[model samples]
Target: MNSNRVRAVLVAVTAVASVLGAPDQATAEPAARGGTQWKCGFYPTPGDPQGTTARYFHCAYNHIMIRVHWSNGASHLGCIEPWENHPFWRDGGNVVVNAYFVPVTPRVLIAPSGRRVCAASQPTG
Candidate 1:
């Protein structure tokens, strides 16, 4: 290829890149602290969760679901309780929830259920 042709190709590539924003891992996800940074990418899949209404963010976590983590690698039945005090809100050692359950409720279940959160959601598990 001639010098001008090569230059033109390079310019086109740059233009395309500018049009499509680059991936930002740092701001995309949070880290464990002192540990390596969390991998970049959408932890949970995109799209609105079921039962999400125009008042979504205002009302979160309609139902109560508990996720138990076992040191020996086993799943436990959920514990029910008021928000914030529930075990489902926090993370445990050696085990982690498939996704972070976002439980927020201004009042009762008359509104939409809360959304389940994630880190970087890929097509395949």
Candidate 2:
């Protein structure tokens, strides 16, 4: 191959390799420390004309739902609901839902129940 053609091929290969070599470059780390985790309960707040309004209770076990926010600017929602007898909600009564925001790609973890949602800043395991 001509010297110029070879150089061009080398450059192309190097570019491709660089891209393949760093798949995580575009994504952030997951579950990094210093991130914020919220543990709250979802319950109907009294006095609402609607009778019940879901509110964050600052406790997990009693929470009807849980959400996580990661320091990496990511968040994840629990897959279990407090009313659904989820393994996470076994202790029910005044339960505090635990959630942490992870710094990773695909930053959201929605519960299978579709009632909970979480988001992350990066990809996580």
Q: Judged by TM-score, which candidate is best?
A: 1
- How does candidate 1 score on lDDT? 0.27
The models' CA-based lDDT, in order, is 0.27, 0.32
RMSD (CA, Å), each prediction? 21.7, 21.5
lDDT per residue as tens, model 1, 7-120: 354345434433454232123223212363223211322232532111101112233333333333544322122222221121223322232233332122211223222211
TM-score, one value per model: 0.21, 0.18
What's the lDDT for residue 61 in model 2?
Answer: 21
**How do the residues 22-100 of candidate 2 rate in per-residue lDDT, one tens digit apiece?**
2321122223213633223444344545333233423222222245332334334432222221222212233223343
- With a 3 Å backbone cut-off (N, CA, C), the pairs that clash in candidate 1 are 42-120, 42-121, 43-119, 43-120, 43-121, 60-104, 61-114
TM-score of 2: 0.18
